[model samples]
Target: MTWRRALSVALALALALLLLLVVYDRPLRLMPWRKRSAQPEAAERRTNRGPALATLGRGKGDGVDLFKGEPLLGEEHIFFVETSCALDKPQHVPYDSESGLRLSPRGACAVEAAAAAHPTHRVYLVHTCDVHRRSLAKDAAPAYALAALSIPNVRLWAVPYALHFVGTPLQGWLASGALRASRWPVVHASDVLRFLLLWKYGGTYLDLDVLMLRSLGEKKNFGCAESPAAVSVGAFNFALDDPGRRVANACIAELLDYRPDLWSYNGPGAITRALKKVCDVQEVLEMTEEMCGGFRLLSTSTFYAIPWQNWNLFFTEESSEEIMMMIGKNLAVHVWNALSHNTTIYTSSEQPYAQIARRVCPNVVAAVGDTM
Candidate 1:
């Protein structure tokens, strides 16, 4: 009788242990720490595969190529905007196609320089006009744009304004046709688009004329001051996360009081006004990152090392070595294309612009042999 009782006790202990294991298995696997630990590994895998392009939205019959995978936009992107009719109508400038408008050599040089300077970051050449891939075939697209696109990190894309402005504060204003009625339609449109782009998909925005001199590094949510008093929207950075979104939202909101008749009202003016909402504009000049809620204001040397008033310096024959020394620590040089568009750059000439092009955008310099 004692031996039989011992056998029953052993069997009961085994059954109780098995029941506990069965009950805890699923819950243990579903713990919060397990999911938290998996996120970093997944992100690492995506980064190792290199940057990929994804289609955001496309209309019927739109010839834009849909890349089909990866995130649409992120902190790793650097964007350049082309808002003029230059994509469809010839600007009679260097690299302009006889059949249609194409990217200018200077523009291509800008894109190339950015890609070369920041190999890890993806550079996007965004056009406000409709772009058909068929239109970008060998004969239609200029050699400069083609050469720039050959770089692994450079991409050309056309995004619709309506799609970009959808959920933002600019949506109702854009839908009202106020943009069409503006005296400076192209200028105002460019301003509106920049703010909207930053608001939706945060990243660095550079005017097509801005040339990158070095890696932008991990700088996020910042703008360059054109002078001691005001910030320039020509080159700015806004991250894709929460902090960036807040400042971008403020800039978009300022557009509600858009001034169509004023030239700088929407572009530089909007950004300055937006900053005023959070802090004293004068304090921004002091270079404090915490001034406007983590928004840093870089000095004039960073982007506008050569101001627009001195735009002629780029084309004039000067000491290339001295110019380089002046802007050596500068992250970029804004060529002030708005004021310097009429000026011509020749390969045979040894001007500051030509010299910089040879070093930064050698491929473009080689493509457009004599002039740019």
Candidate 2:
């Protein structure tokens, strides 16, 4: 063939090869996936993998001072920003003088109910002050707070607005092959800052999107579960011990000064890793399908379940309904996809989740019902 013809043939082959690579990339990554073994020996090793620290009530040791020095339970400020991604068309849903938006009710209820259920445990709702957020309009927080106030135990806190990052500086320098690529720094920073505030003030941290079915103290042990099918420990419940808090604070502080990469931001991962080195991981209680529908705090050999994997398990139709019912059974039905709901609850906003809470956790509902 002529030289021009040969060049054209080579280009066509290269294009075909590139297209083939792209098509098969996902399957290739998914194939040959190893199932994690749940051997008894492995579980035992993981349980005791960390060093011996001071023992707490649940036969778990509280070693090293993670936080500077602080109390574990108190008035925790729980904030859920309707991240640019999570919100729907509304700038902010209307807050009737009576009830709140139906979108984030369950999460709001969890904080409010948990706070009311345990007076010693205070939970304040925190919202990002960023009004010009890409997705939803501002006032969503205020609307949410109005509904939450009806619950008696819930309080509201607001952070000064800050600009949302398009991407952290660290992304450019890091290779996709590196672990840091998976990290979400802006979101992590917000979460970590909240935790720092909780630790410094002596309280707990909770994501607004999650529902609380049982008492953290009752659960005792801390291990990640795959949510929906299993709840992964992302930035969820943890007692604010000095060392743990310090580790969290240090992680965020370090990110601000050093890495400047959002992808490497692992708040819970950092604290859990540090604690695992010195403390025993307690027995992970299973949040079964009966109580967890698609989501449950699953039993894993590791300290916490992987969030991405666990949440992906939540997307299926089978997983979603199962998790919803389970939440109705064990905890309140969370409805993580609350923003998707289009109806307005005008009379009493808390009624939907409250009805489920009454049915599932009757005693808790009875106790807090009058308050509501």
Candidate 3:
């Protein structure tokens, strides 16, 4: 009787142990703060991140490929664009994004500025489509990306903006069938991607035209003022898990609710609408330190020292000592590249932008090599 009982108990224990092993095999990693997924990028992300990730709080976005937006040593600075070809569709192949993704010399200067100014921060040049490292070396815009990639803290994030990561409130709105695919043009698509990046990663966002002259300093949450009366999301900083980002994530859902003129529907107008309500201020310029986006409104002199209308002065005017002094005061300079991209100019040191870029972000000019 004793032998039979012992054998029976042993068999029962074996069965229970096997079942426990099977269950625990998958669930054991869920025990505590550790969350490393099967993907190599996830592992790399884990190794690459530092104190900033701890500061960001690894509560929700711990696993999966979708959560590629991880924190590194310092802060993440994001930049994005949609190619003219990608505007009308949901899915974007690499070719669709190549046009705008390629970096011109001026665009490269912008990248160099940010990377050099905030050497410790993680600078991410995000794009939609497949951009190869070799391919980037062949052209002007890609030279910027390649140059930026040369830095340990800088990387390129090539996620298919609207095509992938259909998890945001903005994606839900897009899928709601409010507007036909034709209505979602490149400009609108770009705007949509920018909001998603801010909501997901919660870092600073900048336009490709901006050149950082100095470190962003203590202020971590703010947007630049295009004018005394208007705020532009061109140069912006928002922390990860920020509620204001959530508000922007939600507000941009109405992107196609009513289409206006191109710029009004997708560019500054879109940001104006979202930030106004999020910051709880009627006038963007009137927003104060206590306010949301207004908390750190960098005046036009801070970013857009020369307004768009006077964009020519950047090229025509020489960098005399006095002008250089004024430019030095600003943290970054927006060269108004959008307005000037098409206009041809013999890029030389005589141009204020080229001069400043050469001084602050030499890689941009170096990337140009003998061509410059």
> For every model shown, what is its TM-score relative to the native structure?
0.77, 0.42, 0.70
Per-residue lDDT of 1-372 in model 3, one digit per residue for the tens? 699999999999999999999989866645332454445363336432211111111125421122233434334555544344343443433322232344466666676777777776667666554444333333323454455556555555554444433555556656654334435455565665666666656677788788888888666667777876666767776665455554556446545454633554665666666667777789877666667643467677888777888787777655445566767677877877668876544445566766786787677577666333
Q: Which candidate should be chosen as best, given TM-score against the real structure?
A: 1
lDDT of 2 at 239: 34
For residues 89-187, write the lDDT of model 1, one tens digit per residue. Answer: 322335345424357788999999999999987787766555554445433666666678668777665544455565567779978877766777767
Quality of model 2 by C-alpha lDDT: 0.37
Candidate order by TM-score, decreasing, is: 1, 3, 2
Model 1 error, position 163 (Å): 2.5
**Model 1 reaches what TM-score against the true structure?**
0.77
lDDT of 1: 0.72
In angstroms, give how far residue 8 of model 3 lies from its true place. Answer: 31
**Span of 10 residues, lowest total lDDT, candidate 3:** 49-58
lDDT of each: 0.72, 0.37, 0.59
- Winner on TM-score between 2 and 3 is 3
Looking at model 1, the pairs that clash are none
